[model samples]
Target: MTDCLFCRIIAGELPSKQRHSSDLVIAIEDIAPQAPLHLLILPREHIGSAADLRDTPAHAALLARMHAVAAELANEAGYGDRGWRLVSNVGVEG
Candidate 1:
């Protein structure tokens, strides 16, 4: 996992436009945003991709926390009322 980009960012070894950070997740602005407000919410611990997170309770908790952080950020950014999209890429196609 030492080679994982997100892991390095969470470890403070890489520079990122960090919006929020906690023991569960780290939310950072997308480097090449496709939208006006694009953020990448990632788990502190690397798990490869969404497919890696079977159906475990811990993974479910992490995902829930990620969504909560995204919603909070969207609200803070003035997109809560208008709404926003949440996208996740999985596997090699991503």
Candidate 2:
């Protein structure tokens, strides 16, 4: 996982690090944003893929925190309750 792009970003080894990084997650604008408010909300901890996510309390908390950050971002962007989409890409196809 040392070679993972996200891991490097989280480790402060990459310049792509955004202003929204925290202990639990890093929220960056998508390099190729397809929407007006596109953002890539990634975990600071390196999880190999969505398939690698396990059903545990820690995992659940992390996931919840991710979504909460996203919602907060959306609301701050003036999209509160207006509807926004979150897309998750898993495995190779991502």
Candidate 3:
């Protein structure tokens, strides 16, 4: 966990262009963004993989938080009333 790059980013040891932050989550622009509006959303904790999500039992709330954040982000980015799409790449590459 100490060596995890994301943990370092969350810890503020490594600089990140954070777009949004909350006590439980953080969102930042993807360094190698494939889309015009690409953001990497992750937990404030060191959740390295999807399996780690199970540890956080309040899954629906987490998703709700993500949706809220995404909507706000989209609006701020001028995605218009239709809003932007939110995708989570499981095992496949985007």
Best by lDDT: 1
What's the true lDDT of residue 88 in model 1? 94
Model 3 misses residue 11 by how many Å?
Answer: 0.7
Candidate 1 lowest-lDDT run of ten: 1-10
Error of 3 at 81 (Å): 2.3
Point out the higher-scoring one by lDDT: 1 or 2.
1
Give per-residue CA lDDT, model 1, range 1-94, as digits (tens): 4999888899889999999989999899999999999999999888998988978899999999999999999999999999999999998897
What is the TM-score of each predicted model, taking all chains together? 0.94, 0.89, 0.79
| Residue 27 in candidate 2, Cα distance off native in Å | 0.6
lDDT tens per residue, model 3, 1-94: 4898888888889888999999878999988998899998877767666655664558767877877888889899999586678887664453
Native-to-model Cα distance after best TM-score fit, residue 11 in candidate 2, in Å = 1.6
Error of 2 at 19 (Å): 4.4
Ranking under lDDT, best-scoring first? 1, 2, 3
What's the residue-level lDDT of 86 in candidate 1?
A: 93
